[model samples]
Target: MSSTTRTTCQSECLCDCNRPGAACQDPRFVGGGDGITFYFHGKKGQDFCIVSDSNLRINARFIGKRNQNMKRDFTWVQSLGILFDTHNLFIGAKNTSIWEDSNDRLSLGFNGEPIHLLDGEGTKWESMTSPSVTITRLLDTNSVEVEVEGNFKIKATVVPITEKDSRVHNYGITQEDCFSHLDLSFKFYALSGQVNGVLGQTYASNYVSKVKMGVVMPVLGGEKEFSSSSLFGTDCAVARFSGQFTEGNSLENLEYGNLNCSSGMNGRGVVCKR
Candidate 1:
């Protein structure tokens, strides 16, 4: 994903002309690839989400300074947040550090609702009901993977970035939002014909061409948000499905790889049939 993104981003940015080769700022992908693309360099103290075709938006936001009174400095990650139709879930984690975790089920909801982070036999997290998915932590690493079983998988890794404190902030870092971002990767196990999000919206489009440049950049000129939480990116998220989120949880793929998330029994909210 990074390789393809680099090639594509270089082709289209405001700093480029029809010239053969030149370097521009790091690219922020708003659309591309197998129904998936993410702005891994999410601003610190600013809220954002990595949207999927499931009409689902997953947010690992940071909360530190208010947008009205902010600076161009690094902000701490205060929560692991989630958003669906409306409701939000924020799990508490280390606010000072970006590469760590807090504990089991320390979270709150936007609607003041109660949410739980069920530990799946010490492997991953399975707590959502509708449009079920699994959150798996990569062992011996500072990253987590979210998967809709045989449907799709997303991995978000926090990479420590440092500079000489120059005023120039690339990777979408501006005065109000200058902090760490993510090293993101995505792979789909099975294609859910119905989809949403940037990738899903432009997966194989004729009107929106990736070769043209600006066509792929996600146009999100709207209000932004933020949260703070632990290492479990999508695992410790709050889900509000208008429909009943039910399925059988077999959890066959316990490691960090492609999984065959098949259902043998049916129930609501991460049900595992034994």
Candidate 2:
């Protein structure tokens, strides 16, 4: 039996659900992009809930260390926890579960527990190349159109790992450290035109997760001309947008598919009607 629930650490105050911190003020980020509202009861079968009120419906974004330098750049975001009902696990496991990173090197294993994304600047791995992160679809409006080609860069920062505050594990019970301590904010870009050795970029990181409908797209890295591709089974719903669109810029056209990148967001590259 395990339990956790937290929000109260004020220092920079934003409270957005993608895990960016001033620590504590988790009213679920009130209403800025109109995305933040949570309620979980669990135990029906085991664990499964991904917020409802503010309507996070379903979201995911992960793009790791492109070049590293955004407060030790090593990206993170995994708000997942909604399988409709399969007993959906993690942090509330039922079958096989255990995911540990504690700070920022990142690990993996899940049927449950994968809602982490840290860049709190603790730098230790000393990159040769491990910071090229991607996991998208969280831009509630403020201009957005990300197809990308070359020469583009965008950043928004915040970092703070963990520090434990209240606990009584080992069965005694009483676990209050919902998120030991965390702070991560992201928005990055790079991709304009005149491509050369293969360069492209895309940005969207404020974090949001619910992923788990078909389950199969998480291997990352293939072909390598700078690659990553995703579009969901199609219903108009969107996710996976990290790029390189040259050779006449792909997304088709509608004014380049309304390319705007911020202020209501926009990016057009549709082709998922299997």
Candidate 3:
């Protein structure tokens, strides 16, 4: 039997993009292969769920800073949400880091940088979720592949006026401050416990008018994470999907099943089943 249902967020839930993506796509998905998007209003101490592939698989809300009056402030809060879960797969942002986990059913922790900012501003906000992501399924087998791309633009300068030196006062920062933007892209393919690849790029532009570039691509030599001996071989199926997002944008992909892999999954040294 197949079932289709949709639940409007009672309030703003986390998945990142202010608009909806992923889950609301079609009919009778019943938790089929799809991902969710999320967004924030820049509130301090706000609590919302970052939508992921499944309700049980999303991220906690990105917390904002509190004011000297002990009130939650929105200005510097980290905006997070937007994630993907394929078959038994899971990918997300937790705390200040990005991570990938499976059915082991972990509590969901943050990995990598949580928020990306304009760059040269004296204060440093932690890394946030990537700008956009895309996932695609391989032909025949349940194995899947994903491509996540994004840009992080950090402000280069911050000037706040305060009467005294207080902890709350120290966190004050504004968008008018100097800025920098880092363009980034990441890609990963997982099958079982063996992962075939990982890639990332960081583009930096400082107010000093200096531009620095860095690239992190797949290291040809490494131990595989999704090997035949890994649980993915016997316990899980894989899918593929991908999409793009702007900074402070949240959206989900409800089209995992919509991908056509009849030509077979793309890539060498990788085998897929239909």
Given candidate 1, what's the lDDT at residue 266?
14
For model 1 the TM-score comes to 0.40
Which candidate has the highest TM-score of all?
Answer: 1
Which predicted model would earn the best lDDT?
1
State each model's C-alpha RMSD to the native: 14.7, 17.7, 22.8
lDDT of 2 by residue, 1-274 (tens): 1222122222222222232111111111111111222211111111111121111111222212222232322222222221111222111111212213221222221233453333333222211222322222112211111111122111111222222221221111122312221222212122122211100111112323221223222111112222112111111113122222223332221111111111210111111111
Higher lDDT: candidate 1 or 3? 1
lDDT of 2 at 184: 27
lDDT minimum window of 10 residues, candidate 3: 198-207
For model 1, how does the per-residue alpha-carbon lDDT over 45-128 read when each residue is reduced to its tens digit? 555433332334444444332234333323333444444334444443322222222222233333345544353333666545
Per-residue lDDT for 1-274 in model 3, tens only?
0111111211211121111121111000011111111111223333233221111112222233445774534232122232333222233222312111221111112333222222221322221343243233221111122333321111111111121212233544333321111111121222112111110101001101111112111111111211112212221121111322222212222123222212211111111111
What TM-scores do the predictions have? 0.40, 0.24, 0.21
For all candidates in order, the CA lDDT equals: 0.33, 0.20, 0.20
